[model samples]
Target: MDSVQVRPMQEDDLPSAERASAVTFFEAERSTRRVSDPEAEPRSAAASKQWIDRMRFYLSVDPAGCWIAVDEEAGANRAVGFAISQNRGRLWFLATYGVLPSHQGQGIGKRLLDAALAHADGRPGIFSSSVHPGATRRYRMADFSLHPQMRMVGTVDRSTLPVVDGLQEGQADDFAWMDQLDQDLRVAAHGPDHGYMLDILRLVVCRDGARPGYAYLDDRGRASLLAAAHPETAQKLLWEALASSQGPTLVNCITTPNEWAIDVGLAARLDIGQEGYIAVRGMPVPAPYLASGHFL
Candidate 1:
């Protein structure tokens, strides 16, 4: 094992962190496909950038909670592993934790995770989506229990949108209200920076008689994250998202016990892939909520 130091993530560390994440994801995907689906395609450049952007969003909002592992062997100063987390009140979300393939067995990833969680100060609640077996085990060792989770991917059916009273498409400026609604319904606080998703996603707002709700969908109409005052409102937003997607789309890292959300996905005929687990540290999140971004 190299003499690696885990330290607070700095502005200068973004590039290295991004690179390490890309490498780790690519390696993991390749390994998974080799064992489960040899015919699967490799990740595209656009996909890799999207992964980096997700991590960037977390780093942008919670730089202090993010940590990077620097290998200090023979004067080399570089990031071999990194862990990024978002501490939103009682909900501490672990966005990503990975070590370069060459450095995997050295405990660098565990060290980075420990430091990242330490920022939460033993907060009762923690959340993470674990795709790697090793990561799932480590999370369990940290006392996070596993829950059913999966990723759904498919081409959006543009014709699925149906007219629903009071459902309006919104723009980026409408994010403040949407974020407030999200915080109200979610198990944890989501910072105002959530509006960042609006820059790329199309926001669908549901105003069903004073109860306002919204869902974030890619330009083509696939739902990412959604929350509503009621299930009817959420279902309306989900349908609108299904109608808007223009091409291949996905809703990732959703907790499966949220039966309504899962049923919606099944009804829409989306293909479920890469089954994984959602690890929760404290009280588990009661579902029926939309899974959005990387942390969800």
Candidate 2:
């Protein structure tokens, strides 16, 4: 373990970091009781590519919070683990973290987490949605309390939704508006370069002539209700997103704090899937709307 070195991640290290994340995550899930749908297709290449994009996005916003663990004995300083974190106002989040399966039990992950927490510096709240039980346990040991959650999946039939007036499709140009909304609603400024998000998801907004809310849905139909000025706006935006998506649409990290979020999930006919836990330390901040499982 002493042969491993921890340092801030460079842009060049992202590809390998993504690969390490995939292997570690896949192997970790396989070790658990979590079952996969037998009829489901093998993991998609696009899914793998999405991890790379997400890591890059997190890095773009919080470069200092990203770290990589390398095995110095490997000569090339091979990356064996990594962590991506961000401070969204008072809410600090561990966006993602993983150690290569082969490198487990060697303290690399601890070092990476230590670096992330040091950067966080006991911020009011730090959060994560942990996929693997081992990860949940690790976070628990780190003094983070756990909240149960799930991946809710269902058919999103837009036909069932009454046409909400003033709702319009959003574009890349709406990045600034969305960032401002995020700051106002969540007290977090996620920055304004989200134009890149439209490249990966369908951006939709509910504008009461003044931008009440927005949502993002990818090609595969995974949708996230980013933020809403109020419960009614959140409902409308959620309905709009559900109306527009296809296949097995998903919303991750739904908790008891938001009755409207849960009601919308039920109204959309989303079925509860594999359970996960959101771990948080410090202040208990409410997250009625989450952008994605990976982000929160």
Candidate 3:
């Protein structure tokens, strides 16, 4: 055991921080028996690349919001915990936070979080949080309101798939209107984040009549992010997402504000389960919207 110090995360710390995060989350889930295969490695190559890329993007955009805890013993200065956050206009979001199980309960997480919160600068803040008791306690002590989040996962019933219409492939040109929809719902436009998301996810959009909505789906047809002007439009976009899936689908980050998503998932015969929290400060849960865990 050694003294740990919390400091700004450097570009060089990405790999070690990524490992710390992955191991911490895996261990947390394993403790709850939520991990189906305990023998599987926590981070796959593709997932590591995605995480490192995101950390690089955050470091470039808001270096002040990224911090890492390092074991300061001689020859042991490795990252043991980390927190990454980002600010979009008046909104601040916690991108990721984790403390290695080996270093848990030593106040390293709190120190890292305090460092990260400094970047919020009094703006409204939000994050998708795992259902870890210690983490929940910390968020509550920081004055965040935790809204229980639900997730629907399973193979879609193809026979029940409806004829969803009005959705077309989205492009870079659609960013402006999509940003407006973002602002209308969450009080901030996901300006730069939209570009990042567009790089990796397929965007499906609906602009029919007065109902304008957009959803970003992964190759698996899981909705990573979605927002709309009306509940009906939101439901239509969700149904379209499910209908387009090639196999099992996931629709996560569903708060009480977005029951339309639950309806669509249920119609497709997806099973529902409680997962985490949409913790927020100074704002209500966004309705008719499903938030991105990384970008929220």
Candidate 4:
């Protein structure tokens, strides 16, 4: 292959770039729901708008990331393939190497990747991303390890929950304790995000009469429960909010590869689909959890 060209994505290129991404992503076999579902990206106006809005987030947030590859022969160097990365001191991959159908397997995909990973400088953090089965083989060919982690969605209606006994949106004064601890925990787990560590404020003192605990929704519509003193408090808080939320209630939770999330889906009677997304962490994976929409 003649030497391929790589460059930074231009300001005007997102439209065509995203359209190409949608075509391939939505066309995938198991990507049926998240990629094609009304609630997923590549579907509806909100999804497209979100993708546009997040370009800046992808650039500033993903360290060691961002590159576009093109087929010089086709004069299609307008990011025929591109990468999205979050660079917060540590590297996290939002998505990398989105190629249009015409460019697949023509070495253009590998060229785009080689350009991106080349920036790793040998000892930098790993090249990370999540892929469904269709993209899995390609990722494997590039030497990225497949993680066992899965993204699961659970559902609950607004009737099965116990009465929300106490979900006071606590005063800032009361939050100092939780706030500091939260920040410390976040930085320890995922490094600094300036004030981002305290960004999610779903914690407030809740009481089922005498029992006091805290639970709050995180930024990504995901929920977090702080076991101030008891484990059940978190569960109760989440269950209460979930059962009371509008209709066809669903909550996305991130717990280590396990069940409360898995079983919740089973119990809520929601279909369990393994999102083609596989998180690629070299050795340590940063916590996108502290900030809910954390992709990279």
Candidate 5:
């Protein structure tokens, strides 16, 4: 026996957890041929660190459950694997299991998953990994949803919208309008991560010469470009962001059904990508106006 053991995640375990998770993801990803590897080992390390940091940040924001697997006696508790879950039906596994390249075929990966799954308690979840063919197959074999891509829409060519300069000088009416929109959005999105949305949801993007546009980003990266006091301003902001994003070029403005603003995406002329569902068990049958912004 490898003396392997599993337990609730410890906050103290973050550093080691990051390392193990990084190594596991790197090699498995390499095997999968999904995304291009970063420039060099040094840059790759930085990117991994960034990713792990994000995992930690996201975990802190989880407000649900998080866990880790360890080899008790060996002190090899470098967080070889971990799982995180949230309420209102949300869970995500950001793991890098399987022993390092040299440590493979030793049953580490399988054990990690078994333990993680055991912790799931049949809860609903969505796994995040590259969409590489092999990796996709692996997740599918693991029984995750293979077709839950969000509907992403894109469009272009707005000739005369007001360009919001900066958020500093928007009028009081604009602020009041944004506040109303935010509260409306919150009630609409009853997801686990939706509660922590204020920080990400409340945004004011503006142009140098005019009013502002409020932006709400949900737990996922799906975004919503709200109706603003200044249509020209909203249009210009959308135009600029679209040019900058790796999109369907513009912002993803899909909201829950109740969200009156969900239609903003359509109004923006964004090419709504095919509707995709997240594979999971717990996500409540969505209510209304549940516009998810993005997984930041």
Candidate 6:
């Protein structure tokens, strides 16, 4: 551990940090699958330009909230762990945190987390976490209330899909209304993150009536982020997302307060499974919201 040091994450560290995260999460998922479905092959995390680009975006927005643990032993400055977070107004959201399996239990993760958390400056915080015991314990010690989260995954039963009304293709003009909805639901607007998401994902917006809502759908037509002023509006947006899917889809980050989402998924005949936890501090789990793993 003496050879390892946690320091602020730099643009140059993005590739190595992303690799560390990929390996860490891959092993974690493999371990979980060994218990839940012994025969299932867990998805592997491969390096991608998109991951580095996303981390670069986070660094551009909140460099102070990102840290990397590097081992300098044997003249190799290898990234063994990393934590990336961002501050959106008064809210701090952790984008990614991970320690390589070879480096686990060496206190590198704790040190990286502490450095990243220091950037929060006592503001409210939130992050979607895996069911790993050590990680959950650390989050609990940080005072975040862990809310069990569920995910719905399966090929949507198109026969059960309903006609969702008022949903239109969103444009840059909808950012103002979408940000307001974000503020109402999560205590702070997503701000610039929306722009990045819009560039890569499809934005479906329903600003037709008093109950406005918006959802960002990935290329596969899966909802990546969603929020609405009312449950009915949320359900409509979610229904549209599911109906638009080209193949198997997933709706994640379903907290207990968002039963409307569960109803929509169940109605679509998607299988429900325990995903992880949405750890939050200084706020309750937002209602009718599906948070982005990298931007919540």
Of 5 and 6, the candidate ranking higher by lDDT: 6
Q: What is the C-alpha local distance difference test score of each model?
A: 0.71, 0.71, 0.88, 0.49, 0.45, 0.88
Off by over 4 Å in 2: 36-44, 88-90, 157-159, 209-211, 285-287
Candidate 1, pairs of clashing residues: 220-244, 220-245, 220-246, 221-244, 221-245
For model 6, state the Cα shift of residue 142 in Å. 1.2
Query: What are the per-residue Cα lDDT tens digits for candidate 2 across 90-200?
Result: 667787888988888767777888899888877844455555655776787788888776567877655556777767779766677777786675556556335556666
Assess candidate 2 and give its lDDT. Answer: 0.71
TM-score list, all predictions: 0.85, 0.86, 0.95, 0.63, 0.50, 0.95
How much is the lDDT of residue 270 in candidate 4? 53
Q: What is the C-alpha local distance difference test score of candidate 4?
A: 0.49
lDDT of 6: 0.88
Q: Is candidate 1 or candidate 6 better by lDDT?
A: 6
Which 10 successive residues of model 4 have the least lDDT summed?
185-194
Candidate 2 lDDT at 125 equals: 45
The worst-scoring run of ten residues by lDDT in candidate 5 lies at 285-294
For every candidate, C-alpha RMSD to the true structure in Å: 3.0, 2.9, 1.8, 6.1, 8.2, 1.9
lDDT (Cα, tens digit) per residue for candidate 3, span 1-296 = 44788889999988888888889988887775555534535768899899999999999988999998988772355889999988889899999998989888878788888888888889899999988888998999999999999999889999998887788999999999988888888979999899999999999999764789999998888889999999999998898888878876789999998888898889889999888899999988998899999887
Native-to-model Cα distance after best TM-score fit, residue 110 in candidate 4, in Å: 2.5
Model 5 lDDT per residue over 239-260, tens place:
4444334434434323243223
Cα deviation at 111, candidate 1, in Å, is 0.7
Worst 10 residues of 6 by lDDT: 38-47
> Model 6, 1-296: lDDT tens per residue?
79998889899887777777777877887776645554534334433678888999988988899888888983466788889888999999999888888888877788988887889988889999988887998899888899999999889999998987788999999999889888989999999999999999999999966899999998788999999999999999999999889887889999999999999999999998887899999988998899998898
